[model samples]
Target: MAQELNQLEDASIVKELQRRLNEKSASLLEMEQMTRRLLSLNEQIRHTETIKSEFISLIKTEFRTPISSLLQESQQLVENIGNTDVVATGSHLHQQLLRIDFHMKNIFAAAELEAGETRNAYVKVRLESLIEDALAILQYVVKQKQLRIESTIDLPEGTLVTDAGKMQLVLMNLLSNACEYSYGGDTIRIRGTVEGDRILVSVEDPGEGIPEEHLEHIFQKFYQYHSGKTRLQKGLGLGLNVARGLVDLLGGSVHCTSAPGGKSTVFTVSLPLKDDREVKDTSDGGNDFMFEAF
Candidate 1:
């Protein structure tokens, strides 16, 4: 009996040792997984830092030319005061100033949005005038690309009232992107119409349409198509992201539709004019502004 008891004690000790060894192996596996996760997070941080640096460099490059032009143009106006056509030179100066103003406003707006300092200033503004002004602001860009702006705002005067500044920014970004993505001499269509209590504005561009896989990701902050479109266009990739954020804040939604090849890309923004409840649809198909690939 004493021999049997001694054997049982030995068995218990071996079982205990096995349990501890198993626990140690599991702990080592967990540690290895944790280390891998940590390495992945570090790599992401490095990538974010690199993108930010690129954005900063792009901003500097964008500002330098216009600022330099403003200086030179003003100096020329002062020196050759009588020789220069006062009206034409003044118009040139105004355009240059507008370009600077546009950049400053967009950059500041983006910064403010990043800092969560967004606040709406609601005031009465005409929809037609607002759109025309956005187009006017982007005139230089359009002219550079040789793109045509075929705008039609059908909403009646004083019918649409919202945060004009934010709306203008939304329009500006959309228009800018339209011009950027379109080929030279392509026509950009901007249409605004009232469907019940909702204002639907769509901007269409006839450039190389966004890929089917990339449509879902275009609005992600600083997201650019690195493969097919990186060489075709250059941007900070903040425009669409900012546009969508502002739309959401303003109780509106933005949608995009594009074909596969070099067909066309379209973005539709639906803003609530008054009612926040369900948009009353009269048609059998439902929503008037369904995203249709052109």
Candidate 2:
């Protein structure tokens, strides 16, 4: 009986030992999972910090300079009332305000897109006229940089039907970027052509070429290869991202490719000839698309 009881006590101890070991294993796995989660959260925090810094720098240069110029330009016109041409000053003022307006529009558009509040309006749009209007918005920037424009538009007016406002914004973003990136004294090409019921528009700039790695990430919001106040390029970093979103919403796609010999970058937008889907109410109370004089 004593031997039997001793064997039973040893068996109980072994079973208890097995239970404790299993509990320890589960605890270890949970700890490992927690550690991985912590690591992931840390990486996210770091990325957000970098983006915040870039946004601050972008606002300082992109907005502050133009607004300060508006004030200075007005003061100069006032100080030399007869010396400065009234029409020229007014035009300058108009361009600066246009810059601000475009910038604000992109920001709000991006937000609406993120929140999915954008209303899509389907209409017959003039492809040729849209290109012309994009050029007008950036006329001052092009002249300031002494950049030459070589454009070829084979598209007839009202050839394509899609979201007119989104289309204009995409063109404006692409043209503005070309103006910003092109080397002074170099010519930028804007071309539109049709192939098999699809429309293709390309904007090529003779700027320092984008690296292969940077090309992939260029369309990411708040992403810049070089950031901070000293970076050569200044933007909200939303231009390409917003363009891609609007293009996708319009049932089109946009991509960037390096020009032959690699000293230039070309951004090409591809779209179908028509989207026959029923139109819905506008989400943001946005203005109707209108052509701007170049």
Candidate 3:
């Protein structure tokens, strides 16, 4: 009787161990399936982003030809015409064509920055002058919106080591965003200062501020905000993301602040300051994008 009881007890122990092992095996299998699904989703997202980048590139390349032709024709008409009326009409058309061209280029640049395809050709650049140039680019938008542009630069006038073109691109996008979100007759204040070894620049616009929840994701690519009230602006939502990406590439960081009324947004970018001896001046005398003749 004792021998029979020992055999039964051993069998029960083995059964319990087998059951635990089966449970663990099932759990591991489920976890593996979930990991596989997540990877598949990630691959799909990457594929979609690639498709978007390619599509935007194609549009930019194709659109430039017609836009350039239109601009040239308008320019010729303005110069060749003797009538004031005809010249004025030609000028209007020219400005519209230019705006369209610039916006398209912005779209292309935004996509390139996001895709990590933007080529950086860093050279000696005048940091102060670059800020001025960027302000000039958005001068037209500011005038159109009747917003005041107040700027202060504390950087020394010399050769600054950085990517001139890329810096200009970042400035253009930030200024463009400021203008877009700002109300007409609002004031856009831009301030630049040196904090230790970093160049801190901030653009403040008292327009419609971003909501607290949306502020965290504002830098994400293609993030559209809709409150079921009305469409705020027409955009591919690539501007801020592109700006952040370029800033990051330039060894910088960006942050934002939105008010409770959701009517003001302030963006700040901090970049590592290069030695003043390496800075070079690239100013075009005056704001290039501002049209004083008009």
Q: By lDDT, who's the top model here?
A: 2
User: Per-residue alpha-carbon lDDT of model 2 for 69-147, expressed as tens digits?
Assistant: 8998888787777774766987898898888888887888788779877655776667777777877877778888788
Quality of model 2 by C-alpha lDDT: 0.79
**Residue ranges of candidate 1 with Cα displaced over 4 Å:** 84-90, 226-233, 275-294
Task: Evaluate residue 124 in candidate 3 and report its C-alpha lDDT on the 0 to 100 scale.
Answer: 62
Ranking by TM-score: 1, 2, 3
Best by TM-score: 1
Clashing pairs in 1: none
lDDT of 3 by residue, 57-94 (tens): 64565466547767676776867687656766665555
Superpose all Cα atoms of candidate 2 onto the true structure and report the RMSD in Å to 1 decimal. Answer: 4.0
TM-score pick, better of 1 and 3: 1
Q: Which regions of candidate 3 deviate over 4 angstroms? A: 2-81, 107-132, 226-233, 276-294
Scanning candidate 1 in windows of ten residues, the lowest lDDT window is 285-294
Better of 1 and 3 by lDDT: 1
Ranking by lDDT: 2, 1, 3
